[model samples]
Target: MTLSTQERTGPGDQAATGVVAIEATRLEKSFGNAAVLRGLDMKVRDGEVVAIFGANGAGKTTLLRILATLTRPDHGTVSIYGNDLAREAERARLSLGAVLHSPMLYGDMTVEENLKFFGRMFRVPGLSARVLEIADRMGLTPRLDQRVRELSHGYRKRAALARALLHRPRVLLLDEAETGLDEPARQVLDSVIAEHRAAGHAVVMTTHSVERGIAASDRVLVLAGGRFALDEPSSSVTLTDVTRFYIEPEPGDA
Candidate 1:
């Protein structure tokens, strides 16, 4: 589907109209004969939050990477905001904000400089104001002049997140977002997720903390063997259930 730039609505406007923010079907990936994702399928609607839970090497990061258009799937179709990710990568990128394992920030640059750079890259209007807004929201305003390499790990993560939100992306892809966050930082992350959902943006995250993941999401998906072993509404699953699934193999695993 080749949509003209004029036909595209702003990310926020698109979400309010209930558009599909992300769609993936029969996704498959492999590296040197080792299959990481096997026929995975997922859809995240605007105003929804989907959390994917998986163990190490469960292809969680790989899945996020593909969705963010950083990596291509061996077999599958992915669309962001109705644009084909593989074919219209540039267009799709305009609607995406991703925070993967790497902070994706310039270590030598100041926090404010990093945001300004990304804002310019995304062509975000009112770049200075937007950067300050996001920096304040992420609690990085006070340290805006500090070099990223000099900040603590938690602060660096915050800077990364601020950069992602600077353009008000329609879709957010987070990979273990809470990895180095402290309690307060986690609260800020939660608040950001809540705000995005309230504004009709979609979020897809991969996390190991069942409680935290499920708590922030509308749906929970357990990825095992490169496929969804369990997919259900977050309200229907408990922490105990997730723990059990992780601790005890669910029959038929070597």
Candidate 2:
């Protein structure tokens, strides 16, 4: 379903929970002879946070990549804030913020440079203020001047996150964002997610940390056999349930 002109302007009040920010229908992706996604359907509403949980090679990353517009689906349709991915890729990208497995940063560029560069690309208002604010929020202020390659994994991850959030995108996509984060960084991540949802933005993230994922999300989904084996509200599922569902193969899984 396409969004109306008024709805396509930008994120609205947090009360507009019915608005769909990210929609993917009949998504199918295959690499060589192996199909990674099979007719998958997903819809994330504004002011919502959805966490995707799955085993290794369960197509989690592939799904996120497709949503982030970093990888194209062989056959499918993706719409971000009413913009069709294939027909309006450039427009669609304006509303999306993604942090994938790769840091997507220039190793030689300092953390501050990376953020400012992306800020300019997004045309963020008050670029200087935004950069400092995001750096502080992500705890990268001190390391902002340090080259990306000079920082450790945790710091680099923080820099990437800062870059993604600098634009204040309407749709946020993260792939294993918590992988290299420390306790403080994780806390910052949680705060960022909360603020994004509060602003009526949508977030779709893939994580192996089940408990943390459930805790930080409004809904949880388990992907298996290139499809969602289980989908439910976070309030209705427990860690044990998710673990069991991930381990137990579905009818045609193997």
Candidate 3:
């Protein structure tokens, strides 16, 4: 079935639950036979917080890249808000707010300047108002005069988040979003996610901290060997399940 035929515009529920924001099926990605992803499948519902966890080189980043539309899969199909990524990239991308590991900011640009630049790119209405609003929420208005180079890691993250929201995307794709956050700063990120969740936005986050990931997510996915070895909900399962799956016994020693 195609994506556009699905209902993804409003905050609808999935069957008796919530509406799905992202639906990926038979996802496959390979780097010249490296086989980063193997028939991966995932479903994220609106207002749901999904966290992904895996060891290094486990295709976690590769899967996120496909979900963010930064990279494409060789074999599987992806759809966002029912729009096919391969067929209509623009329409599929318009509903996304992304924060990848890469920084797309200029060091010389002030916080406001950077926001305005991206605002223009999306032709976001009420640009100035939205900028100020997000700035205040992120505590960036005080650093409006500071260039991207002069800010600390936490503030820079806030600024980057502001830049992403310039277009008011329906879904948030965060890659290591809380890497540099302090206790208070991390709290803010939590607040941001909660606020967005309350506002009916879907979120897919990649995190290294298992505790934080479990606390923040409704569902958890562990991608290893280009496939999901474990897919379960945080509420019903314990960390022991993931540990048992990841930590295998010695080879032929038992």
lDDT of 3 at 148: 93
lDDT of each: 0.83, 0.83, 0.76
TM-score of each: 0.89, 0.90, 0.88
Going through the candidates in order, what is the number of backbone clashes in each?
0, 0, 8
Kindly list the per-residue Cα lDDT of model 2 for residues 36-124, writing each as its tens digit: 78888877788888889988777899899888888999998999988899989899898889989989999999999989998999889
Off by over 4 Å in 3: 1-16, 247-254
Tens digits of per-residue lDDT for model 3, 209-235? 887887887767776666667666666
Query: Candidate 1 at residue 65, lDDT?
Result: 95
Candidate with best TM-score: 2
Candidate 1: C-alpha RMSD to true structure equals 6.4
Better of 1 and 3 by lDDT: 1
Clashes by residue pair, model 3: 3-82, 4-82, 12-19, 13-18, 13-19, 14-18, 14-19, 38-226
Provide the clash count, candidate 1. 0
